[model samples]
Target: MVRNSRILIVDDVVDNIRVAMNILKEENYEFSFAQNGGEALRLIFEVGESFDLILLDIMMPGLNGFEVCKKLKENPTTQEIPIIFLTAKVDVDSITQGFSMGAVDYITKPFHAAELLSRVATHLELYHSRELLLKHNINLKAKAKHEKNRLLSELEDSQKEMIFILAELMEATSDETGKHIKRVAETSALLAKYHPCLNDEDVDLLYHASPMHDIGKMTIPLEILHKPERYSEDEFSLMKKHTINAYSLLSHSDRKLIKAAAIIAHEHHEKWNGTGYPRGLKGPDIHIYGRIVALADVFDALTHKRHYKEAWKIEDAVAYVLDHRETQFDPELVDIFQEHLDEFITIAISQ
Candidate 1:
């Protein structure tokens, strides 16, 4: 009793078509009629609407029922439309040919009304059920993809938070204030943005990793780390070891952000002219991450008051960085620093 279902009744005899429609009239289904196989094929092809079940005659002039069924089955567009053969032929070979031609079942002529109604209802119900299942499967897959993305987003946030907490803990061991770490992170990201070779992802990684550049200072003795005056020759030598110490502490991590932090920690103090300690890596030999952070670290340190020195004027800090362009820092990085000095000063003032 599916009122929405559309059924096609095809027969060369007009009386037979009327008989079939009358039998199905109680169900209130929309009906269509074709007098011959050729007309049936044309109706199915030209009609914008689809037929739910096709009741087709086996023998007719111009393209018999078997021929129409075969052609419909061969086409992808109409292949899944169920076809039932209705004919006078009751011979074994006739039924076999009907089945072979993709008919769902053969209903011999003089068929019982109950039998016709039952088979039509059965196939229509099956078709609707199959459609529902396919839609359910599509919805399930979409939900699964959404959940996967949500979990990944949460994991990334947790990783970034852990990195920041660890960097703060390392800073707690020395005279550096937490604000210094924040300013260095901002400055490093700003510099990376202006560098032609770095992409947006690289800039983000530097922003998070620059805070740990002096994590090695945790390894220095508390007395030397907190001293209010310049370090003695021996004291300075021991203090320089913090860079290597920071590297050793973080180098074994497999995470990309942690690896970047380790590189920054190890080489941020290395000079461009090879005069720096702890490997003395110079110029292009120094990792770009290290070179960028080196300039960021010095600029922030110079402008901020610390246990060992009072804060210098912003102008003096700017001049000092410009003077050391190719000796203490990468020339290219120094140029970027000068170009974006206003933005850098804003970051320092903000923190």
Candidate 2:
């Protein structure tokens, strides 16, 4: 007990409260008295935050101290207030019940003055210290969450910047604008949403990785890349190396986006029927990312003019894709592409 500290005494018997108050009145502590559990609860609800500690009597009329303690412990605001049970029984069961109901300590009736002061002082000190530690832990968790969100934002920006720069690098070989890469990425991501194999992470990785599908073209000679006529066999062989070159450029990194990009670059040229170049992988042998980028790249390339070819009509390009289903492209992917024709057209127009 200390000066200015509020203590509540709840007992049906007036003499018992008088005895406890007299024992600690010399210390200048403030006191409040209640005749039963109901009165104690009313006072607590009215001004529980003003109370530093409570000296409660277990045996009472109407509501018992155990019931009052349970109510206090269940409340968010009053739960932290230290409770000391004043019991006459001194039995193990009563004491266990008091502590179990969230009492900090229990004192037997006919209390000694020195013992009362010591227990009160110790519990008050422990309670306030625990409150300080709780506040610190809550603040620490808030700051940690804020820092985690900031790092994720930075990583997202880094991925976008890297995708943009690499896409431009690949398009520079043929002297075309980088919008082709952007359109391919958007189309690939849109088509991927229909895939059973891809989750959210897979969709995001494909969107970022698809832009690098033609990164191998950056290694090809400007003459071959921009030739007016069809490529000679030797020139075409050099040109076909772009896919392998793309894989080589991206395969060194273990990052999810880069690893997916490597696979796309490596197998995008492989045909569904084993006729296309590089590895000549067919059907399910090609990774899904590869198959997706292959469709995206060819679709965008056909609808737009290139150094070697004129742009085909949208209908003609789409018909060509349908004609080669399961031969030049994955069959299901072609179906999805046809199903979402309007969306692809809108993307082609917008991007």
Candidate 3:
């Protein structure tokens, strides 16, 4: 309905061109004419004159209307320009060929002025509306992608904050330092990266979740948690319940990181030989996340001085891990630990 819509008219006869222009002039459209199909193509292609609709005559000398329509439809730039065959060829074959060639409609030589105006207006409106819809869909998809990324970022931030807060609460009640938690997180992530079954995302999840392995220590009394001497039978029994306490506290969450933390907290103490506590799960029956963090937590704990024990030398810690393999730790995880020993040493020394 916008004023001054541009239209291209191609006809060998000057009268036919003039008639279409005259009939359409009252609609306030700008008109361009070509005597042959070649000129119409030149004006549309070489000259780059944009048009809303094209009124093509079928019987032109060079590059007849059908050929022009075919070429125009093949071109991506001009393909969407609506074309109406304005000619005297009213046979079924000619009409079928025109439609097949991508002409929007066909009009016999003497078109009614009212019909021409109505058809042109209808097709132009349809074309513009389609263009608007395509753009809207593209913008909607882009906005949805942006919103999804923003929400994911916020969720990840919240997970990290929750992990640190709970980990620090455990640290506050026990001898574990922030550095121990950091080293455990880094070592767990490093071990997960080299594990055959785990992917990068799994590595990241373990990295964040490993720090909460002792989150249950927050529930232990300071007398037991910070005891300077080895635990007696009853004291050790009560101490071992920290793992169950951590699982109980964390397993209620539906969040992935928290759920992974729950598994690590509960199973990090389990021995590969079924000598470990809580459920006596052994070997592959243990979750990989639990198996990975168990090794990391012990290695870091042994290298660092605790209230109950002096820090063993790094070499001694490594020997202890190798010695305890298959008894206290998963065999495969111990292999990973030995293979990546240098990296673990670097993380411990740096942190």
**How does each model score on lDDT?**
0.88, 0.87, 0.90
Candidates by lDDT, descending order: 3, 1, 2
List clashing residue pairs in candidate 1.
none
CA lDDT of 339 in candidate 1? 85
Give TM-scores for every candidate, taking all chains together and pairing residue i with residue i.
0.73, 0.72, 0.74
Model 3 deviation from native, Cα RMSD in Å: 5.5
Candidate 2 off by > 4 Å: 1-109, 113-115, 196-200
Candidate 2 structure quality by residue, lDDT tens digits, 1-351? 245678899999999999999998877778999999999988878754368889999999889999999998999888889999998889899989998999999988789888888998888778777877999999999999999999987887797689779789768767567889889888999889888778888778788888888888889888888899988899999999999998888899877778888898899888899898799898999888888888888988999988778899999889988998999999999999999899988887786
Cα-based RMSD of candidate 2? 5.5
Tens-place lDDT per residue, model 3, 97-126, is: 999999999778687988888998888888
How does residue 11 of candidate 2 score in lDDT? 95
Quote model 2's TM-score. 0.72
